[model samples]
Target: SKLICGSYGTLAVIDEVTIKTLPRPETSLSLLFESDDMASAVALIAGIFASPHEPGAAAILPQPVAAAAGIDLAADFVVVIRLEGIALSVDDRAGHLRGMGGTGGTVETVPQALSETLWRRIRDVDLLADHAGDIWKLSCPPASAPQIIAAIEPHFDMAFYADWAGGLLWLAGPSGADFGTALRAALTLHGGGHAQLMCDRGKSKQLIPALQPLPPAQAGLSKRVKAAFDPLGVLNFGRMHDGI
Candidate 1:
């Protein structure tokens, strides 16, 4: 008679779903800025943080990732910012961002349809299609993100892009890289980065488990909740935990 909606639903019968929606902006647009230097790209993004632009979505993409998305950006890194609202306001903010890239920074805006598609590629790591490796989905502190990427750069050549303002990153580690040691360490350098295996390219056993083991406090709380809701461990087959 009851239903669980998320991953745990596999363990039970589900019937209903709910989706959230946000207010639409009168005019929607995206900005693409490029610089060979990672620091310049990072600095420009930092400047954007103080500017008036309220981006609907914003991300930093490496050259490889940019190419994979068909962005035609030659710079080492590209900073993408999306604005959705009144056309006049959007133009003002877009202009402000373009102006911020005064030296060694080039900026451009793609059509609305193309812009949405590019952002989706970064969001989904679409370019990693057909690749065989683990994809690391990371959530880290916004300003410290650049430092994290900088730290990880020397170890391996990875394709990555970040939804900068959202503090989210999608990175695909190179094959044969140490997922347990190198990947996790890089994700944690800026702060305690919580990672989960969003998708496994190989679909085989991996050094880093799909999900990290829960901490005792969290484990205890979850145990208590599960007991109260589905003590029989019948809701899902170890959907959220080993037992249930």
Candidate 2:
């Protein structure tokens, strides 16, 4: 099940469970970078990417993601990078990433205990609602996350959490989501941003668009797409809008 989140552009890609589980000729390796500042955390990730050897996937966390579950983060910033395929090739690649970090950056295997907990925390947006108010998920490219988050803070006073590089952001609105064009304008001016109307307490039905830029073509396509996936629309019918 491909989770599409855009009307005109690709907002995010949440791979289906089966697609994620498909056997691949690859393996994933996790590298953690510790720092207190977000700049340092991002710097480390960028450095790893700049390396001649680029890994499969990389994640940066200002704090230990494990703490979101229960564990505490001793470091102010913890970045995780994963390399996949051919275990024998991993050593050199891992070494290349570590070398790029200079000193004090600990490159180690992501412990199973912590890895599983963080994975669940990132994928499970439902848990975020418990921490704050009306929750929203924003999916953009990794590099664009920080700037977008800053622009959003002024419009709505809320707590923020991010995943999948900076690409995915989760925030909870202190007030109900009265998201006007102001929110939309900020993102458009500064690159890209999209908001999903998560939970609204006041309305009988959801009041925001699930996907952005609801052009006529996309609006029609979304309906047909939904009908294909869920002919009954039993999932969250009318939650995005009247027609969906």
Candidate 3:
């Protein structure tokens, strides 16, 4: 399961799959907190995660991205925390989050309809869809996000946002910039993480790796596993990595 799940169709052919779906929450609410910058937004998200709220989802959207998602939070950035469950419980949790202070700016509560729209935009990358660039998905420690963003700021004109309480970053960098190298460097300096190229745009795959390179031992294991599953090297050869 581990080998085939993220194999990008390299390991085997999946003819049929089964998935279990959960019933929708009875109600949902999103708490929007205005933040002066990314650091403050991340801090706010961390506080929420530390509390007992058990947020359904959390994200930080820069003003431009928020606007793109039809969210008009007139601030530099907006930290969004969503709560879901029975209507009464959701309302109670939201009130607790509101009283837990240190928000630094205005706070607003969005109803279920708008909350669903906002999360859908975040989940579907609707905020980044109109941008003309290559898309990179970065995963790192939540606390290191601000530093990583700072490190990569000088390399390219980019737009980005954080989800999963700042642990996952979605970035859109100019097509010609060396995104993989720059992002990997930042991740290395701040904290180890992975960056995957989600969209090609105009960049050459030969020039940039679509997936992060594994360590020597892991790389060897990956090759062995690949050979075991597709010995002839015929199934999506080089689809995820070179010479796999």
Q: Number of the top candidate by lDDT?
A: 3
Model 1: per-residue Cα lDDT over 1-244, one tens digit each? 3435444553455467567898867777888888676656667777777776776777887787777778787888878888878889888888777777757456888867888787677666786664566677777776667777777767775666778663777777754336535656766666766666676666523454556567788878767767767667776757656754
| Colliding residue pairs in candidate 2 | 27-84, 27-85, 29-82, 29-83, 35-77
Q: Among these predicted structures, which one has the highest TM-score?
A: 3
The 10-residue segment of model 2 with minimum total lDDT is: 5-14
Question: lDDT (CA) for every model shown?
Answer: 0.70, 0.59, 0.87
Whole-structure CA lDDT of model 3 = 0.87
Per-residue C-alpha lDDT of model 2 across residues 188-244, encoded as one tens digit per residue: 776676766556544512454544556688779877877776676566675564567
TM-score list, all predictions: 0.83, 0.65, 0.94
The alpha-carbon RMSD values of the candidates against the true structure, listed in the order shown, are: 3.3, 6.1, 1.5
Superposed by TM-score, candidate 3 places the C-alpha of residue 55 at a distance from the truth, in angstroms, of 0.9
Candidate 2 — which residues are off by over 4 angstroms?
1-21, 24-29, 35-40, 50-54, 64-66, 69-75, 102-108, 126-129, 154-157, 179-183, 199-207, 213-244
Better of 1 and 2 by TM-score: 1
lDDT of 3 by residue, 160-218 (tens): 99998999999998774377789988999998899988988986466877789888998
Q: What lDDT does candidate 2 reach at residue 206? A: 42
Q: What lDDT score is found at residue 76 in candidate 3?
A: 90
Backbone clash total for model 1 is: 0
